[model samples]
Target chain A: MAEAENKQVIFKQYIEGVPKETDMEIKVSKTELKAPKGSGAILVKNLYLSCDPYMRGRMRDFRGSYIPPFVPGQVIEGFGVSEVVHSDNPNFKPRELITGLTGWEEYSLIQKTEQLRKIQQDGIPLSYHVGLLGMPGFTAYAGLYEVCSPCKDEYVFISAASGAVGQLVGQLAKLHGCYVVGSAGSNQKVDLLKNMLGFDEAFNYKEELDLDAVLKRYFPQGIDIYFDNVGGDMLDAALLNMRIHGRIAVCGMVSQQNLSDAKGIHNLFNLITRRVKMQGFLQSDHLDLYPRFLEDVTGYYKQGKIVYVEDMNEGLESAPAAFIGLFSGKNVGKQVIRVARE
Target chain B: MAEAENKQVIFKQYIEGVPKETDMEIKVSKTELKAPKGSGAILVKNLYLSCDPYMRGRMRDFRGSYIPPFVPGQVIEGFGVSEVVHSDNPNFKPRELITGLTGWEEYSLIQKTEQLRKIQQDGIPLSYHVGLLGMPGFTAYAGLYEVCSPCKDEYVFISAASGAVGQLVGQLAKLHGCYVVGSAGSNQKVDLLKNMLGFDEAFNYKEELDLDAVLKRYFPQGIDIYFDNVGGDMLDAALLNMRIHGRIAVCGMVSQQNLSDAKGIHNLFNLITRRVKMQGFLQSDHLDLYPRFLEDVTGYYKQGKIVYVEDMNEGLESAPAAFIGLFSGKNVGKQVIRVARE
Candidate 1:
């Protein structure tokens, strides 16, 4: 292959607080497709990129994080849809549509072919691999069914209701014969939750001054399951409203990320009194159930039982702003960047 | 029968912050134990009283507490060892030694005989039913084995090291071939943790200016299991020092009990990053394991594999002060009051 090249988004510095646009920069670099002749690797041309809130955690220079910090001036890596341009590895063939951990920019050279899963179904939007049919959807399914363990007629509450994971969690709870209520930061998101997402009730947490009172008004019988995304005062309030033997699936804590001073939770004593079970989990930990997750969620989508919405940015340059939007609750549904179209 | 007299301890008012002697008053009242001739009931002479930290939560008028608040001018009830003096119930016989929820007084008329368990072991000290061989022991055992699930060579950390639950957890971890470190408020307690309790290391948290630094210095390999008795800064520090896939068994948050302003934990994001599992549980939730708990702990004590320490106060009058000392970290090991010990 004559003089191949790759376009990539690079981390410039460790984020201090709320990520700024300047923290990331897009640049193009030249690379070899042959992987130095002897090495076994596959070169991929990136198609779709996933903009997830968890990536913000990797931007910080903290020890003991789930994943390591993105190296400065290097391609920022996350789950992406790509087409294999060339392969030295026997498993991967040229022109194969694949999904795996890839760069934020145009192309990537993935050495490990095992990590790249071949896209089984074609003609559907390949970007769905990054959203509904991928990590976020699996997160919602696993956290709800496996962690929360909601029973029929149980009250389910999801915070950050219109976000990627929360949106799917609410819909799944509704499908599970649960009474679902969600809290969002915007009126549009609240409308989407109640009207589009099939939540029984939705409220704009920004408009509601007292979260505890709002929860009481909506869920008089108390919350049976809480899919916690935005942890802070909301978590504290939900603790008070949890029923006996309530289950809280702690997926994320986006609300406390950028704050210089974290919110203090006073109602934690209720965990013991009410016999509440709160568990924190990562989708990666439960990877053994991935095949089942794909079948269940894809089946739900095909049957028109589930709908996934995404806020798509146009290019790689917009990826930084799209990610920063996660902290301020700017995006609706799953945020994605259409790096390239098939 | 002549009119019977009942001696009881009653709350004078809702306690503010740490409880004072003035907050509670002991009084004697007379009542006939007549249950309309057909009612099943039993009158008991209280033997040993259990002074627990969770009772401090009930002292306040908190709405969502595990146990109900002590009513003004009424008996303060808790788990106690008692002997039935009069029985109108078929299950309970007069002179039977029993353990159940009872009043903090000389005598009580218990209507719920089914909730009470008759003590079968005759040779063991009856007071041991309130501490070492009772709820506290079971709490430490279940919380550690079930929640923490420490590996054979894992590093375990326990806060409030010399307290009731913490003391037992340290010994249990040691028995499991895990390296255990503990924190206490005083040097005396710290020494006891290292010397008597078989902790690998112990520290006085009060003397340490930086909790995070203290944890880092001790747990160089990182903590695999953290038995959290004290929350706030210590909990935050433990979060930072936890190894990947660490388990935090949150048994109590005694540090933040009296403070009007509790510290906000900043390192909770570590839960997602490190894939840590932090869970809070009550001893009663694991009641099914009580029989197994009794057998295991009894064997450990009899075989000289486990030793329990108690700081006992003489008479019922000192019970309130003994409980108050718990919040201030004044009492060592299991704080109990010997109210007419057999």
Candidate 2:
């Protein structure tokens, strides 16, 4: 049998500020279809790759960070849905469908079998595992129910409202009987959040003359829970507008991601005055809640209470542009790259 | 009986940016040595007054702040150690030493006697009640033990390390066997923190051209607990140097209190990457721990394990300058005004 040519997205170097598509390179390598002898390894063909805001952190050579930086001249790793072609593991056999951490390539020989989760549930698309049923969905779930501990009838505000996690956070808060509002960069995204995503109110942050004033208008009583996806001026404004005992789940700082120097949050004193709690959380920390999250979100999806919008790009060649597009808000929803058809 | 003359510090107007001595006025008024008729009030002669950083928030007319702004032309209120001269309440007697919220004046007729705490222990200076044994002390205790949940052998960093609360946080962290470092404004304060205060390491932040480099030098292993008293750039640097799962107690932002436009803090992305938790807390929220705190801190003081420094001013006339000096780092230790002899 002959080795197959593997097309992989390789990170060229550590990025300085905003990552351009040129920062990554597509390198064609060759891999065998069989797992190595005397190993619990599984070889899979990558079907879909997830492009998350968190990936930007991996591009920087930052020490003491949660995840390690991707090595230059290596295949960039991310969450992806894959189809098993060869297996030496008892848990996952050949032709089994799974989703977990994998390389952004045509094929990956996963050595750690425990890291890959078997996607056995029916009535769902495999790509949905990356967007609604995987990391982003679980992030929204854990951050809201565990971190925020939100109550009914409370006012909730979400930043980056049109993104994967924000869309779900808004929907979950609405289902909880809370008044939810979101802010996005574009008018189209604002419309998607309000009309398509079921937010009580949505505003284009770029269009607003003052974000603080816009938040004040939407939340007359003040925000009870702010699912902060963009952490610069939005976090500052949210700090000032937080109600007593308000909770801010620091999801991401996409707005400050590419800056050489981050924007300062001046209104942090309000945290003391209002007795608010602002905390940063990562989805990887709440892996224990994965089972419950999948069940609850799956029910919501079946009942038509949840819908995920995916911006799909065909082929591994498009992966660089798709990942780079995340910082610029060029993708409409959960950005995913299709490495192969299911 | 002839009425006694009472001098008071009155807030002249709400401050726009940095507060000046002229923002407050010393006014002479008259008070009888008795409570009003049918009023269950106690009359107290103010012995010592405290100048704390939180008072700056009250000077601004900004709405949605933690506490209401002080009404212009009214007497400014703050913590003070006082001697009761006349008491109509059954709980308090004449000459009973007490400490709590009091007007910055020669005497105050306290109508709400319930808000005051009777001074029980002796051998410690009653003036200590306003600093080491008062709100600042309790703030340090609650913020460290409760909010941060610091562990032994962990690295701890305290900003504004020579002030009332910051001083105690460093001492307590040292007692816990943690590697402690503090940042102060001047070389003298830095010396005080190292020589007198017993901090393992201390640095003059103003002299350091790069705060991040300074922190990296001090905390080579990275900070596990950051007691954030100065929230702008110091916080930004600390975030970069925080170890995994670090907790930041947002005690105060004395550096940012006077700015018209506060310095934007970048590098919050580290919070997610490092799984850090940054929370702001108020001393008032933890009053339930006062009795235990009094016992523990008093024991530390008796054992010579704890000591507090006081920067005492002569009279009510010095209160304005002392309060204004907090932003400029003029006064050393806990800024106290000795209105009269105990």
Candidate 3:
């Protein structure tokens, strides 16, 4: 059989501070489209790629991290939406839409068929699998419900409120009858949180001189639940304004990712005074809840009760810029890359 | 009837830095023992008083706290083991032994009986109700079991390990087959943690110049659970060396109490990277589990499976020093004042 060509983005080296375009490079290679006889594997054509802040942590050689470091000169693996072009495994067939850990390339040969899930829904945009309807959406759902445990009429505060997970968390809290508030880095993002996402109040942390003062002014009675995305100074400020028995669900710490010396939090004593419960979690840890998450979120989307925002980079070359924008708070909501359209 | 005389200790004023002996003074006053006809109340002779670090937070006029502030020239109230000398409420009878909120001096007239529990077990010393068998004991129990959820053979680290609550937590984790280690402030207390409490390892944090290095040496596999009594730097160090999904039960932060500018925790980014869960709680919040706790702890004590240590000061006059010792890490174990021991 003749070899088929594959187009891919390869990691040039480990990233430092803000990732530059030079950190990653596009490369083309040739591979057999069909798996060898007796080999159980499936070949896929990549449709969508997820651009997440957590990818930054994988770019560094950090000890005691959940995921392994992305090796230099390798295609970065992340959640992606794909179409099965050829399959040796019975579970996946030709033309079947699927989602799982896939490469940042035009084609991938996945040997572990069990790792990928066959997509049952057909009408929704395939790119949604990388954003609002995928890991970020489930993370927001699980963190808000399982960790934060919001109650009716409770005051909810979310940091990085205009980002993928944060936007979904704010909306979910609102659906649960909570009075939602959010903090974004830029004025444009703050406006998006309040106007587009229906947050009761939203603030631009950059514009707010004092975070503690801002929280106090926004939540006079104090916050009941806090969905933390940007850790560091924002987390310290949220600690001071939490009510007794308040819950803090830590989803991400995008702000402290690149700093050689992480910021110090001074107000932790408030944890004891306020009797707060601060819990950190990853979406992969709660995969059991995904089925329920998909059913509820899809229902919300179809009913028009939920709104999802995305900043879609047009091609594989723009993927690097889209991923880097997460640190500077450039993207308004879920950041995704449109590698190809089925 | 002639006015009844009452002897009590009153806070002279709000204190600064380490509380001094002169900051509080014992005063003799008169009060009617009878609850003016329709008032349901009980008069009791105080027997044992609990000197906890949480009281120090209340001593200040902090904006948000679980308990109310101590008013100037008023009796300080905390968990005490007492005998009812007189009673008008149906729940209490004269000569009944009870454990509840009581005055710092020799006598108290309690208006609320809801928070009080009748002491049924007479095999142990009645004074145990103020320490190992009471609120402090339950605080350690719930914080370790329910909050920490320690696994068998996991590395367990406890701060203030020789203190009342820490002593019980270490013993309980040992009973659950965990590899328990603790940090005390002095050589004598460190010896007690290893010898008396049966910890796998004990270190004098004061003697160790590099706490992080010390922790890494002791917990080579990393800490699975940290029972945090002294926060600030110790907590920061623990955060750096925590295993994935490690649990931190934030019962208190004694090290940061006296400082006007508390030390900042710089390694909290570990919460996200390691997916650690840190929660702060009050003993009163878990009152519903009191019966289960009482049964379990009492069974453990009777079976010789658990041991507790106490530093007893003789009179109410010594209460101030005993409490002050808590901030300085002077007391070896649970600090209790024996006002009128049986």
Top DockQ model: 3
Which digits, one per residue and each the tens of the lDDT, describe model 2 over residues A226-286?
9999998889888879999899999888988887687577777777778787778888888
Better of 1 and 2 by lDDT: 2
Clashing pairs in 1: A66-B273
Q: Candidate 3, which segments miss by more than 4 Å at Cα?
A: A1-6, A28-39, A88-90, B1-7, B26-40, B83-96, B118-121
Expressed as tens digits, the lDDT of each residue in A1-342 for candidate 1 is 755656778899887678887888878888766544556878888888998888887887875566788888788889989898888788878888898798887778887667778996643568889899889988998899888888999999999988989999999889989999999999999999988989999999999889999999999999999999988889989988999889888888888777645766767656666777777789888889999988888888888898888998888878889888888989998998888777
Model 2 docking grade: medium
**Cα distance off (Å), candidate 2, residue A137:** 1.4
- List interface RMSDs for the candidates, in order: 2.2, 1.6, 1.3
Off by over 4 Å in 1: A4-6, A30-36, A259-261, B1-7, B28-39, B259-261
Full ranking by lDDT:
2, 3, 1
TM-scores of chain A across candidates:
0.96, 0.98, 0.96
**Could you give the DockQ of candidate 1?**
0.53
TM-score of each: 0.94, 0.96, 0.93
